[model samples]
Target chain A: MAKAKLDKEKLLWMYRMMLLIRRFEERTAQMYGMQKIGGFCHLYIGQEAVGVGTVAAMKKGDYLISAYRDHGHILAMGTDPKPVMAELFGKATGVSKGKGGSMHLFDNEKGYMGGHGIVGGQIPLATGMAFAIRYKKSNQVVVCSFGEGAVHQGAFHESLNLAKLWNLPVVYLIENNRYGMGTPLERASAVWDLSQKACSYDMARATVDGMDVLQVNEAMKEAIERARQENQPTLIEARTYRFRGHSMSDPVHSHYRTKEEVEEQKERDPISSFQAYLLDKKILTKKMADTIEDEIKKEVMDAVKFAEESPLPSLESRFSDVYA
Target chain B: MAEITFREALNQAMAEEMQRDENVYLMGEEVGYYNGAYKVSQGLMEKFGASRVIDTPIAELGFAGVGIGSAMVGLRPIIEMMTFNFSILALDQIINNAAKLRYMSGGQFKIPIVFRGPGGSAHMLAAQHSQCLDPWFCNVPGLIVMTPSTPYDGKGMLKTAIRDDNPVIFIESESMYGFKGEVPEEEYLIPIGVGDIKRGGSDITLVAWNKMVHVAMEAAAILEKEDIEAEVIDPRTLKPLDEQMIVTSVEKTNRCVVIEEGWPYAGVGAEIAARISALAFDSLDAPILRVSSEDLPMPYAHNLEKEVLPSVDKVVRAAKKVLYI
Candidate 1:
């Protein structure tokens, strides 16, 4: 395959999305500390490049589904941050009508299926969506994202086998952040290379530098193209890392990992590296990067305000939406 | 009207629905070239082609989730479970994803999927294969549980379930598939959450569903020989139960007997008995009685299986106890 040239406009947009996710997650952590956001809040701090770059490769009509650590994925899909933040605040005006909190954000109009709470529950759902695309005879594809921990689940294997058996048009992207809520990959999985699991289903597989947006985008574009053109599924493992603790309840450096290890990993921060790359490539200037950061900071703050002022769902709403 | 077996009625329901809407399709194990395990989907693959009548591998959880995923995006899928016993393997998909997706997404997705297959005791299939799981589904708020007693009811209720915008657990019986009943040639639908009076009388109200409705009918017949009349009511849709109908019948009869094929503890009969006590307590002339399967896993021996399940004798005994006869 020839090396596809990256468009300057898309590169700039990816930078903006990555920064926006970073700022949004930082504020979310603050809001969580203020007791504004409750429940299991998993921030996508270090995995911004994976979400931004992979979503950038998807077409307009294509569908995307992911696990609970999903604020970045939905934001990368171009969903308005206001409703997403309001949903985290459990407000009526929020997306999903505030019924789904941090772990269940949904933007149906954007083709962002949901922020599924279960570990690997979204795999079969994504395959099913791909089945629908084929059933409808459309050129659309589906991108399913899950954490590294989900690969050990039976749902993951079952869905992969079905997708390969039917030749469904889906890309099962694994965001391997090295931890399943504190349990390291070495402790949980016998096979270290998650991409090898795809070989069991006789499917295509790839592994990419998830911290680099350009590389992630390149790999995703090729896989998505294969899905749209040949109607074949691909399993791509994006090697990434989560900068924060698993959830709001856990400390940044838990007993499982030392503070020095977390600090060393932070040196290879995805946002700063991508920002430096943009500047060096002349696609984004220092002045432009500063301006984008300021804009995103304000935008994220506005979203926080919107969520703060939003009203709680009415008493009658509890009974509604349960049937239809 | 045409007389047809319960299996044929279900086949007709799937055929008519698939013909009516291009979005509706059937997918399950052995549903294609092999027909259905119970042959309920006989000739569907030949009629609709492989794309519509898909044959899935023996992966219940995977296929069940796939059906839900398809339904989420506007395709109506009828997922056959081979038997309700196998459906236990896909409970997470059915209960968590299918049932709760619409609610959890705040109504962003609608899972218009139907999971239908045989359930309950069939010959001596034993404990693993035979189970009356109506109460398990009935406990969930988002799911719609339906158990049709006759061919006519099965056909009509399944059509309604197909058109419904919610997940419907359409549990059929392995034993009742061969039973024949008169079904209308013209298209008709039995509205959900409505009960049917198989045999009406004044002495006592016999509440039953699925295969137990037949047991209640036989018990009603035995009660008639002793000059004790019983009204047999079948609440085909169990989740959104026809509570009003049962309460009204109990109000008139003032004596009620709840019959079910599941174990006694926390069973569907216990729920009905509780409702009767709450809704028509003052109307009762005697305490309501329940005739349920023995509180144990179904035994394999022919005599033990019969003894474990609800029979005409048990229903009659419960009816007599309720009526002070």
Candidate 2:
């Protein structure tokens, strides 16, 4: 099949975003090791394309909700890395005012609804946001992303069922990273094809290569369009892989799959592959790619500086924000 | 003021709120097409249409989460849990998401949602359907737990819960649905965290809420015949408890008894007793007593059900114990 051609500028922008998420996650992992970030850090290392491409397809007003591996999604939504890093550092200047830490990054102005920690918690919430958009007669769509593990949760199926029933303007985007905290899809789900879960709800569904940013973008575009135009929900299962363990606490190797398997998957790493594709298409020049890498690294370092310099939350701050 | 059933009062409150705000909507199982399982949302669908008043599959967790999500954004969602028994399935969304979202989101999102339904012992309904969950909801910090006993409180408090910028667990009683009380026809709202002195007395304080208010009132009447005046106080909201009202009444009476339909272990009565002891300890002439359901799952038999639940007789006995009778 012939590949769909994307605009050079759009492709380049997406490539930059992919690099940003990759670098951001790498830094986040290092920060977790340094104990700068605390409280359950789920890295989105290998799932960069899934977040970058899907976010590229979303409209300005559209909302994004994701599970704990949400740093990439929030960064892709264009939130400055400083506040997000500050949040991870538990500083008062964090996007969630330091209260939400790593697993609960929220930037309402950017329409990033949350970085929900619960596995399937954001599913129904995204569906409801879609319902709200329809209720208010708005064109906005909600893209709720979760791992393959979340597909087993009752909230996932329940939300999908209602999203279809209500014809909600939502996209239930499953970033199928294969393993659900050491348990593979074979062990976690009855059905290997996670997209087939949508068949239960009789909703529009598709499976895309999550390693290919272009493929993911195309699938997300169709899903988001169907949601915005037809007021319908779509279940897009992006077959991706998490390069890291389930969380920061998980060991780098041994058990659950060998180091060779990790190396084999790394050859198809979304960032490296997408960079090669961009270079092949001449959408990204050698100089542009190097500059992008340099810029992102500098930005990440500055974010770290911002986080380190940021003040910790005051004792009184803890009491505030509990209520409206 | 006009007389209305507790069901009708709830329906009116939802209707008025939906009419007042375009964002407010109702969603739950049988809420629309079936006119609600308990008929509390009877006319809401007809008045507001299917869009505003939605009927959902018996998926409690889904709809409860949908309500929370919509509330996170500008919408005010009133999710009906058919009965509080059914709400157990959605407690994750209610407690973890709805209650904690505002705090978790650092006040970026205010969950102006109400999870309201008939709770507590009702007729011969067995264990699964008749458990009272007021205390379970009250235990959560970010939740405003409302237990409306009368039609007036039901309507007024439901309105307040719908408008409040936090998740409100508005608990009603299935047994009290058909029970009629005077509800004002004019617009009104009973503030949350405020207790109402249903009846004035100088001898003893009878603190209760929801269906137990009826039990307390009945017991108060029984005590009246015994020449013992019992002040009846209904703490409409449980979490931001009306401590001042309870303590003042306890101080005035010098003795107190609490009544609730839930089990005695860590129940609403237990919490209130602790609060009263802390605030009104010096003024208390006797130890505060509690009248609660027997610590057992509700049985199917009518006689057994009656024995398991708090009753007027039980409330009277509790009051007598606290009164040193």
What's the TM-score of chain A alone for every prediction?
0.98, 0.98
For candidate 1, the per-residue lDDT at A126 reads: 95
Q: What is the per-residue lDDT of model 2 for residues A1-324, given as tens digits with 9 covering 90 to 100?
A: 116477888888888988888887899889899988888988888889899989989889899999988899899999999999999999999998899998999999999998888889989898888889989998899999999999989999899999988899999999998898888889878788889988889999999999988899999999999999999899999998888888889975569988998889998898888777777877788999899999999999999999999999998999998888
The worst-scoring run of ten residues by lDDT in candidate 2 chain B lies at: B99-108
The C-alpha TM-scores of every prediction are 0.99, 0.98
Assess candidate 1 and give its TM-score to the true structure. 0.99
**Model 1, range B1-325, lDDT digits (tens) per residue?**
7899999999999999999999999999999999999899999999999999999888898999999999989999999999999999899889889988887788898999999999877888889987788889989989999999999999999999999999999999998999999999999999989999989999999999999999999989998999988999999999899999999999999999898988889988899999989999999999888888888888889999999999999898888887766
DockQ score of candidate 2? 0.83
TM-score, candidate 2, is 0.98
lDDT of 1 by residue, A85-193 (tens): 9999999988889889999999999999999998898888999999999999999999999999999988899999999999999999999999999899999999999
Which lDDT tens digits does candidate 2 get at residues B93-164?
Answer: 888899888887788888898888888878887899889888898899899999888899889999999999
Most accurate candidate by lDDT? 1
**Cα RMSD, model 2:** 1.3
Error of 1 at A321 (Å): 1.1
Candidate 1, superposed: residue stretches over 4 Å from native: A1-4
Docking quality tier of model 2? high
